[model samples]
Target: MLEARDTVEHEIWWEIKGGTSNVWYENWTKLGALNYVVPTDYPINEELVDVSDLIEGGAWNDQLLHQSFPADIAEHIKSEIYIDQLQGNWDRPWWMLTSTGRYTVNSAWNMLRHRDHEDSDFKQLCIKGVPFKIYFLLWRVLKGRIPTDDVLMKMKIPIASKCYCCSIPQQETIQHLFLTGQFATDVWQVFKNAVGIHMNLTQMKQVRYPCLKNAPFLWNELIDFLEGYKPILVSKIVYWNLPYDGWYKCNSDGASRGNPGPSSYGFCVRNCHGDLVYTECKELGINTSMVAKAMALKKGLMYCFENDLQPLIMETDSLIMKNVVEGIWECPWSIVAEVDIIKKLKARCNVLILHVYREGNSLAYFLTNLAFYFAGTSRFNSFVDLPSAGKRIINMDKQQIPNIRIRNAKNTSGMDIFT
Candidate 1:
């Protein structure tokens, strides 16, 4: 317990209520504990009791906060942390590692595991629906515990190390069995050809087919995936839908020249009567596509807050951002800060962020593309100000005319071994 004290301290989120949590020590705010960032010589008033001292009349004591801490810390406290005013409420400690904020054995196990989960390779290697024996085999291969001739010889077995699967007289090492030998090469070739997978497998050593391990499909699964897939006539009609009366819709999008290269975000607002009201776009410098998508929604939410766009429906084409913001999926660590800010903005603005197909978000898509050519931000306040193509989309949306989205969906009718 003593050894884990420092490490587990970071996972406990102190939910401030009556705010008895220590102002300098507790992690009620995501900006981190105050003592870590505050100056050691900074003056502290002994009379100040706890976090509740900074709250007055069911709201944050802004003036006191500004006087007590730096400007940024004060802002973070106000934005990220909220308070409840129940008379006997206590600051609850929640396990931050789990989605439900409750401690679980699985979450703890995942955190304490020695394997590198950050690589997202574990799930790929342990393909679901694959037999338990296959899983055991893969695990043994990874651990170099498989009973290959080299391993058997090391175990003091009195037998010549000879290849079991082929005519070659090569020593039956793990590498030869899985990677370099002729039999392994043929198996890999069949797997690759069947799966139509193209990957650079030259750099990996002792692994015959690194790509297959990294892919979600197993070797047997590829047989069906290759012969089972055929072009089927499938069409999905994606179109912009107008918000109900007394509400507005904000469609936002993000664009990146390369995934982490010159990224940009754009948003457009439309009233129930289908009038293009406000639109804005700006480049986000160098950032990932995920960040760009999240920032776009955040900017849209901010606009809603500023314009009093209440009972608003916000839409974006980023499914990941939608699920993350809605708490349906885990938030990626890279954009945890941005997602936090977005969640607060979403709650404060009373905005419902939903995922829309890219075809339905054409106007915002146009604005996102426009940001690339411009050096700075751009804004439009009127429908008349929109370019011809933008105006055309709005007009079509006004008439409820759907923009057709046709996709060549693969026919999965040919059933085979899913396992």
Candidate 2:
């Protein structure tokens, strides 16, 4: 039995080139047998020959092979010449057991234990934004591996297993503790009300807890996924400031009273030193804020083009506008014409299109608000002789004052339409 096992292992193994393998006895072929052998009647100079004896003039010697084996076997062996076979040094053993040709106990155990089981819920629990600890705890709970009171009691740990949150003497379990209990129901209701989601609790609970295997995994995975998804659009704070030297920073904003109500686009341009170069507030007839934003960008680009403002950096607080201009997103058909105009103007000079926090773009936001008090378009070419409010906000930007950012809060509104 041992010899049979050795033969099987030997048939599947080969030595690397630098080994002390006897070319006559060692199984060097991937087939684990000699491809050609010395003919029985042939006479040889020595009892053993190494592979180097077969090489002459940097190539396999046809004369030596023909002298050792018949033409048929010699031709077959010559045709099977492999690059690695010819170039390798005998460094280590090569086995066909693992991918790396080197095996470990862990790899063998995993190979033996691999079975196709439904583990989709466990996989989905590893959602990108969820905390790792939360993912691990929920995974354990779904696997019935958590040390809950009932589980601890079953393991001979002294503990009461009854539900304590309500007056009922029900045994405490994952389902009863988190889904069916009165306290749990009230907590879920608060979450439901806050998120504006409604579902029949009895039906959900009925559908949730029956399985000793599948149901809990699906339900827990879904709950954790929603909890993980709730924070994707949470507000972030980013400071805005002046452009690099030899560049003009233009910040534009678009505002509307209603979805299709009175709107305007406003932009304020400043040099690298935060000195205001110009401000424009032009009235836009009934249009969506999206259209106002598109027009505002086009107007800002055109202003730079006409004024020969080379190496400009145009910024906007609208994420939508930034995406549209950078070609990361497509604009609506209504705004495509304006976007094209902006693109043509952008191509004429070195322009950097950027997105800034509304706090950083407060001067442009203020200019848009100024449009609210005006019945017609307003254009100011110089900071001097400007209104006190305008001067104050500009001064704030110049001083690099830190503005307290509020999430999802709008501080100003208006639009600009430039021909």
Candidate 3:
């Protein structure tokens, strides 16, 4: 009929035939009809079996398009081909029947799936290349896939050696490195002293094995305790100034540049009889001048609170800082918070913030200079005799001062002593 029709009719007939071919091909694929190739001696009578039987129990009725092929079959073809694209195997020739106007979806899915599988295989190979014991230990520690200690001990180590620090005969493991080793105990002591917290130092198995296995919060506490204390201890110091009776005087200062750059703070406490009680210096990392001021204030407060000292007078060259602390003027929000903390600490002691001329704050200035010198090498936390270099500088400054003091003292007479 199509062959005998005029050009327009023939074109429509040809389109109908093509559409039918595509639909048949898609249905055949879904029903597994294509699994068997065309047989050489096919039975002519039964050649086209009723494919409709295969569609009865499946997802056919939900997709009928009001076309031919029992409503169910029509629906099946429309849905599986148009919506789900089940025959969409673009990697081979199978996808041609299922794709809509274009077959690119099948092509894209195949390419992406292949690439993903290849990348996954590559990663597996990379992981397999790592040494077995090292990999297992790291995996156990990181992923909580730990084997029993006995099983771990039986596993091969690249280097067969007992623990280095403790010399006890046992396989080197993360547990041993952190728990049983003498070095680990030393580290724990420093940790305990710094935070003022103590815990039983014993074998990993003794400290609640399940804490290591499931309680991540407890594990983190151990890690944080170990990591935080070393620096804190190195920076801790006792400082005092002024001697009573026969005691010597110790003075301290804190300075910051550009508001929040590297800061230097120092303190030297002297007994009533003029004997040096203790001295300390510190170089604080980038922090506001206000922060440095607060830190210095805290140091004094801590010293007084810890030592049971009274009538303690802390001095800084910053008059504005002093006034702010005394509530004589409003402080910037940044400074106020620190001032408030200091005030809270101050309430526990006989503490006073005295504003002095930068000149009068010479000892603190000298200590700050020393702090800068020891910035990276060591933290100034203990009572050390004055460094020779600092002593020389102090003596030199003192000697040069006699020549100028008389004239300055006369000129400055009647000025407010506090000013």
**Candidate 1 global lDDT:** 0.77
- Candidate 2 local Cα displacement, residue 409, angstroms: 14
| TM-score list, all predictions | 0.56, 0.43, 0.35
Top candidate, metric TM-score: 1
Where in model 1 is the C-alpha error above 4 Å?
Answer: 39-49, 82-88, 109-230, 243-247, 252-267, 279-356, 363-401, 410-419
Winning model by lDDT: 1
Q: Candidate 3's C-alpha lDDT?
A: 0.49
At residue 101, candidate 1 shows an lDDT of: 72
Residue range 1-419, candidate 3, lDDT tens digits = 35432222211111111122233222232332221322434323233233332233433433333432444444534432322112323211222222221335455445434544455433453485698877566555655355534345567534445655664556656666666667777888898778655554323433544223322346667666545632111111112234334423335567777656888777656456433456667777776666666666666556656776666667777777778788887755444435655676667666667776556566567776677768542333333457765555345443444211111221223442232
Candidate 3: misplaced stretches above 4 Å?
A: 1-250, 376-384, 392-419
Better of 1 and 2 by lDDT: 1
lDDT of 1 by residue, 58-146 (tens): 88889999888888788867764544353567876767776457787677656666446353544666777999888788777877998
lDDT, candidate 2, 1-419, per-residue tens: 45444344453344434434545555554434443354566565464366656766556678887776567656744643322234446523544445344645564444445646758988889989999999988887888887778888889999867787987668888887778888888999999878655675334544453221222336566566445642212244445576798889889998888967888889988899989888898777677788788878878887887898878999988888789877888655445546766776777788989877788887778777788788877999898856888898888777787675544322122111110
The C-alpha stretches of model 2 lying farther than 4 A from their native spots are: 1-237, 408-419
By the TM-score metric, which is better: model 1 or model 2? 1
Error of 2 at 84 (Å): 65
